[model samples]
Target: MPRERHGTPPVGSRPMMSIDGLGDLWDTLFGAQTDPPALLVLITGAVALVVVSTRLPWRIARNAITIAHEGGHALVALLTGRKLHGIRLHSDTSGLTLSAGRPTGPGMILTLLAGYVAPPLVGLAGAWLLGGNRITLLLWVAVALLLAMLVMIRNVFGVVSLLITGALVFAVSWYATPQVQAAFAYAGVWFLLLGGVRPVVELQRLRSRGRMPASDADQLAGLTPFPPLFWVGVFALVNLAALLAGALLLAGPFLTDAGLTL
Candidate 1:
C-alpha cells in the first residue's frame, strides 16, 4: 500500500460536510432574533426624526430617500411594461428615472405616482419584517435592492451613492452583531417612514412657489384630469397613512409588553 502524503487525507477518507456551518449560515440569514429593548427602538426613532427634521443632516441623508424614490419609478415602469432607459441621482438629493412607453396611459400615471409614495411603503414593509424579528433578512434585502439598483444608475454620483450605501448595509449584514443589526434596521425604517412625508410637503411648497413646474405631481396633473395640487394631496395622504400604519406595527409590540393600549 502506498504511504499517505504529509498534510493529505488518508486513502478513501474525504472531508466531511459541515452541517453545523450550513445551519449557522441559514440562521444568520433567516432566523428570528430577540427583540431589541423598547428604549432602543424609541431612541432609533428619535434619531431618525432628528435627521429628517434638521437641515444639514437631511441634505445628506435624503440621498437614501432619493434612491428609493427613483427605484420606485423604475420598478413601476417595468411592472407597467415600459422600457426603462436609466436613472440619475444628483448631488441635490433629486433624481430622475427615464423610461419609454406610451406618453399617456395608466402605466404612465402609476409610474409617476409611484415616486413620492415608495419610501413610506418601503418603510412599512421593513417595519413588518422587523415586527417578525427578521432583522438580518431586512438588511440583506436592502443590500440586494441596492445592488439591483446599481445596474440602472446612469451617472457618477448615483453610482457612488449606491456603492457607499450598499457597502454599509453589506458590512452590517455580514459582520455586525444581531443587536447592532436590529438597531440599524429599526433606524432606517423609521427614517423612511418619517422622511417620506417631507418630500411631499416640499413638493407642494415648490409647486406653490412655481419652482418645480415639472415635478412628478405636476406631470401627473398634466397627464390626467386632476390638477397639480390634487396630485400633491394624494401623495401627502398616502405617505401620512403609511407613516401611521408603520408606527403602529413598530411600536405595538413595545406598547403591548408594557401593558398599554394605543
Candidate 2:
C-alpha cells in the first residue's frame, strides 16, 4: 500500500476541473500505484476467495449475493415502468421483489430476467472499472447503488443488509488504505461474478423436479418460445461468460506481460 501526499493549490490557481486538479484527485483517491504487481496481488486474492466461496457453505456471502439478486429485480422493475413496491430478503438466502405493472408484458419479462442476470451484469461493470484502475469510482458507485436499494427495502433484514453493506463500502472508500480499498473492490466484483452462477443451476434442478413453480426460467419459458430448461441454460451461459470475462479483465495485463494472449 502507498500513501499519497496532498496539498491545496495556492490561492488563485487553476480551476478544480483543470488537469492538475483531476490528477490530484486521482492521486488522492487511488494513490500513485498503477503497478502490475499490485494489480496481480489484488486480482489473485479476489479470484482465490471467490473460488472458495462457491465451494464453501458461507451464509453471509450467499446473503450478500441474494441482496444483489433482489436489488436487481427491483431496479429493473422501476426501469421498465413498474412501480416498485419493495424488496424482501429472507433468511434462506432467497428474496422477492414486489412491483405494480402489467402481469404479462415486456416489462414483466425484463424484470424477471434482471434478477438472474444482475449479479453478473454488475460484476462485469465492476470488472470494467477495475480494469481501468478506477478503484475509488467503483466504491462510490457501489455505495450509491446500495443506498438506492436501501430506500425501497421493506423488511428488517433487507434494511439491515443494505445499511451494513452501504456503510462498509462508504467507510472503506473514505478511510481505507488504497491497497485495502482495491482488495475490497476486487472481492466484491469476484463475488458478484461467481455467485450468480450457482442459483441458476439450482433453478434448473428444481425445474427438473417440478419443484420450482414460478421461477424466472419457467416464467421466461411461458413468455417466449424457449423452454424452461433452455432459459436456464441461457442464464448459465450468460453467467459463465460474465465470470470468464471479468477474470480476463482482471488478469489480462499480467497475461500480456507474460506474453500470453486469450
In candidate 1, stretches whose alpha carbon ends up further than 4 angstroms from where it belongs are 1-20, 260-262
RMSD of 1: 10.8
Q: What would the per-residue lDDT of candidate 1 be over residues 1-262, giving only the tens digit for each residue?
A: 1110008789899775599988888887898888789988899999999999999999999999999999999999889988888899999999989888887889889999999999999999999998888999999999999999999998999999999999999999889887898889999999999999999999888888989988898888888999988999999999999999999889966887989866
Taking the tens digit of each residue's C-alpha lDDT, what string does model 2 give over 8-75? 99989975597888888777656533544646545655674656465454566777778878888888
Measured on C-alpha atoms, candidate 1 has an lDDT of: 0.90
Query: At residue 236, what lDDT does model 2 achieve?
Result: 90
Report model 2's TM-score to 2 decimal places. 0.82
Measured against the true structure, the TM-scores of the candidates, in listed sequence, are 0.91, 0.82
**Counted clashes in each candidate structure:** 0, 0
Error of 1 at 164 (Å): 0.1
lDDT, candidate 2, equals 0.78
